[model samples]
Target: MVVLGFMFISCYKGRLLPIEGKVKFNLIKSDTYTLLYMETEKGYPNFNLTIEFNLIQHGKTVKVELLGVYELHILLPAFGPARGIDSLMLTNGLNNLLFTYGSYTDYYAVQVDTCIHVIPIITKFTVYDSTLYGGLVRKPNIYLYPTSPCSVIVKLSPNGRLVKTIPDYDDGFKVYAYPDGSISGTPGYLFYEAEIRDVDLGTNGWCVSQPEIISFLQWLLPEYGFNPRECDDFIQYWGDKLTGSPYYEIYPITLEQIDLICP
Candidate 1:
């Protein structure tokens, strides 16, 4: 079974363990998912590490023991094959896992070995027609931020065909960015369109009244790292569209959710 990613933290009941320097995480790829095989370095024989987390399908706390160079078999599905389009809300029971020492009381955060590659962020948009229920996602403004000035390559492989893109999204968007987050010496993001029919608008979000939209966004946007100008722009763009319904149920799409959708 394909399992999603799990966030782990290292903890000790009394004294912190030097597991970071002693242990290593090796990614073993299987047909379905990538398994995290943790091994303690040589000379650290009989060194035991205990990990506790809830199982995905069953809500049971499973405690696994980690020995030196033994295959721990921690399946992290985040690095696995994409779940594809229809898998809208892929929830994981093992969102957070903790490594504990003796007595399983106090928790200490330990560093995990980095053994993974980074991928480009795919920014997608969908416009749902509540009355008709679904429609095309037109002109989605997608912004990309790089460390320094560079050319960005964007590949469009949506479930549906890419209708249109400004500046013509050929192979990629070749432009120089700055430290102040300006693209090609100008400001703004990418825009696009895709067929958004039969998409399920899940009921896992806030149901805010029309009058509460502004104040709600004022508090919400900042928490998600949105600047003042970006927040104002987002509010102006989406706030005007909420006039139809008295109460709008808005869901905040997370990065993990987006990765699962268009990975």
Candidate 2:
């Protein structure tokens, strides 16, 4: 009789082990985008589910075909290793499958029959610029180029300082500046070149010349939205302060008027 009672309890526990619940699927609309949400049971909080499906617009019996399934799980201390805690899986057809459940007394299940819409893409504007400076005492020439004609935002960093975020360039090409004071016409095209005149000397003499123009040009070309290519020097000139104050000033160009000039 005791052995027979043990068999009956084992059968009852096996039946209780399988999770029983229903998943309620819903298509939610946010501004221009659509998402799928699932709610298990009557009072369970809705969880966002990542799913992709094609919308079939037919004259009759419009149905959702689930292309794939996704799962997200979390382990709880008291529940041992609860699998498929707050997760979702959708079928290509209009069927929702019951996954598993959380360890806490929460019931788990899946409900089908839902739909979500896709969002539309929007475009905006931005600005581009290039600049050069004599690292010793001269003010840098901040050249504002013609605005780019796209919806991408262009941010300016001067001496690694976040100057500002410009909106929408009406100019045709992207503008970029190099550390050695060379500007690229486009992101990769090296259109113009300027020699870096180091006023203060460390180991080098009075006028410091950097031989890494080729490499420096390579680095700045990508930032302005162009590929690196060789270009000819446009401006060649020099100046010396013969006065009392040993200050360096950019000749023939002002600090504020260095607009985007390609070689």
Candidate 3:
């Protein structure tokens, strides 16, 4: 049931659009092109008009225009036809309607009439490249990444279900704890149990960037006192063997070696 585009401002009785029977699809215009798509469920509000803008050009106008100095961040009417195939190019005959998507084209302009219906706002996300266990802050600890790194930037919670929930990147981004103590959230980062492996920086390790993986997981998890080291797959075993020689340091950690072991 691909439904998430909704908009209903009100006023267009002679059939410019607002049919409400939820028109399925069959209006491929030409009086200067008029075919729109992507209307989700929330667009049940309807639309008409009441224009007035100068907060630098009230997004130009959805119609009822007088002038237009300029401004952008536009996504009018119920919120979107933005899922892929988008269009709104009409300039005078239709009174102005420019709203492109992705790297954002046309920038922004509005004002239209003559078959325009769309509702699209489903762009959730989740992916990684690598990370696992580290103070992502206020810990229940179990981080790992590897599914859309860098290019996908970083994002998680497409709700694949990791109910253990405890992810917060403070918003300024830059949350990497990866010397192998693995923790991530730059631009975007959200992972949930991928069997976990990748973080064996070994050979006198030296993390490489973002201040050496945040000084190697706060010097390998040491909050005053001393004894706080986890890794042998984060010790917590049962049927797969359990015990106490639990000392895992996938290498790469320093702060003068936690000031030579918890100074």
Candidate 4:
């Protein structure tokens, strides 16, 4: 069984050798009511965004700081997020949400306190579909990091929903970027190595027919759009329940699937 969503297929080192893309970054959002705007008189640089998330109904901030983050995706998507959300970013503030991996579905999203968790991939080779030799190629064996040693295993429901999060203070990461626009870090896990091209996130919580995952999602890729969670978000949020959960290829599942997980 392909445990981590990676197939044991024979990958070929194609044309460009180490085909690469930079760790693109851009601001997603910020609050004007937060301290970020209140401390302007002290100069913009003096602004310290200590509050990661909004103060909730509990009347207390969650004290949230992403210890580590990751994602999964197909080797390439046929068509995916909103406007500039896809571009690389370098935040005006030290804090920002790092887009770990994105393509058609935007499979990855991490809520980090200090947006330093940038895992920029450095491709080692273009892994193409062996026998036929055309269509799409993946850049594997890429190296990424400057990580800290903290473990916070967060499992999401596919549409960027938080499924589970287990953190170990010693097993956390401190991710940062380098001068060349590449990122480097020592994650709670061995994150120094990463692939540049899109990779699989995995199939643990949702239902998906392995043979049809790509071709199926691809066929529906261009025209399918509905609700805040459709297609990839639906996939990521609910995840693949394997052969039994809910087959998207046969009939596309709806946002209603979210209710299925309710307590």
Candidate 5:
């Protein structure tokens, strides 16, 4: 799911009216097909409206307009002879959505009335083989910081098995959290690995140089709410291996996707 913020007007009683609200874009995968879901906070309450769905990719655009629709959750049709998953992966360029496992970038737009919204969608999926028990989910350390002392219960729903866990998961971690970001009767942080049988790697990512890697993380980590020490620790852990190559491709997973993959 990715949110490209914009405001739009609503149509009511054959009149165009301005409304102040936002909408969300989601890419969902099912056993049969991939679907695009669009929703808005302030939508047509009592009726439906005609909408134009626009798809742009690799310098080409396809447009489809529908009548009497509220929210959208449509299975994209075949562009030519390509059909089903192959059709989605080939022509619609949805294959680009899988940057790593289930991560994706946007290539769709929506038009209502005269408003056009271009969105960049990002998604993440983790492929864990239940039979072999193998997906090396790397460093996942939990940091808890609250306003004051409070009891905290942290739980994980890994698709596979947990290889390591601090404080021994014991179904869930029960601890006392404090303002200083420390837990009583446990390590200051939590760490674990969710492993499965196989991993699917994506070829799409930022190919960054060594110096750019340092500078980028220095800036990017802070934007994601990482404190100075945490940021330093992240780069320190992964810096050496990345710098070995002239440039390395970096794929970032969103917090939302993380929860979806292993809530």
Candidate 6:
């Protein structure tokens, strides 16, 4: 046997308006339809509203029978506060039913109308863990941590599936590898790494005496809009160049080997 339930919410605005009243329905042989109404108050001039409703049923299974059987129909008045009406219908078969309502506007409310049809059937069943058809199910553990360095240990289930992992803290930033072979760090550190690599002039040395490279980067800053902190290495390199200690070297970077750091 199958049982169904329905619910709805109505909303309005204003102080003196007639608040919407709850809806009522009748069940014949445990089956019937109901209509709920809400009217605007006298003082309230404008009406913005919402409505919500639910359906439930009880029996041996105690299912929320209205899973997809319920429908919400809203009716708005032409003048004053808008009015809303909701209806619920249930077919014969199942046990008990429950309904709930909620709304967004202060003037909003809900009405529940339940209709039950049909009688419930009774049966017996057996339960056993050892004789269960499917295998046991396990839940995975997820851990979130702040941006910093630390050891990450992940455990696997007996079936080689991810089971859980311990959360720990340490110094350094965490890097995420992408399917495209690129990597990204946290926000601040991401900008810093990009800036350092930019100033390194694709080399293993800093800009100690290259005024031209420093000037070029300064001009390019507008194009990248990178954070100032991210360019700290570049700035330091240029400062050393101004002091007559220019470290210029040519190095190459490829997307696949970006993780490698200079000595």
Off by over 4 Å in 3: 1-37, 42-84, 92-166, 174-176, 184-263
Residue-level lDDT for 52 in candidate 3: 17
- What is the C-alpha local distance difference test score of each model? 0.39, 0.25, 0.25, 0.24, 0.45, 0.27
lDDT: which candidate is best?
5
Count of backbone collisions within predicted model 3: 28
Residue 19 accuracy (lDDT) in model 1: 33
TM-score of 1: 0.44
lDDT of 3 by residue, 1-263 (tens): 11111111111112122212111111233465433322212122222111112111123233211121121112122321211112233443323332322222222222345543223222121111112111111112333344433322233331112223335433222354544334554212242321111111226432223223334444443432123333222222111211111222233233333222211
Decoy 5 TM-score against native: 0.47
- lDDT score of residue 263 within candidate 6: 13
Which regions in candidate 5 have their CA more than 4 angstroms from the true location? 1-130, 185-187, 196-205
TM-score quality measure for candidate 3: 0.19
Error of 4 at 104 (Å): 34
Pairs in clash, predicted candidate 1: 10-108, 11-108, 140-192, 142-190
Q: What tens-digit string does per-residue lDDT give for candidate 5 at 82-155?
A: 10111121233323322211122223432222222234443222111113332346556678889989999999
Candidate 2 Cα deviation (angstroms), residue 204 = 44
- Model 3: per-residue Cα lDDT at residue 93: 32
State which candidate has the highest TM-score: 5
lDDT tens digits by residue: candidate 6, 102-171: 3211111122235323231321110111111111111111222435544333222221111122222123
If candidate 6 were superposed on the true structure by all CA atoms, what would the RMSD be? Answer: 26.4
TM-score-best of 1 and 6: 1
Each candidate's TM vs. the true structure?
A: 0.44, 0.16, 0.19, 0.17, 0.47, 0.19
Model 4 earns a TM-score of 0.17
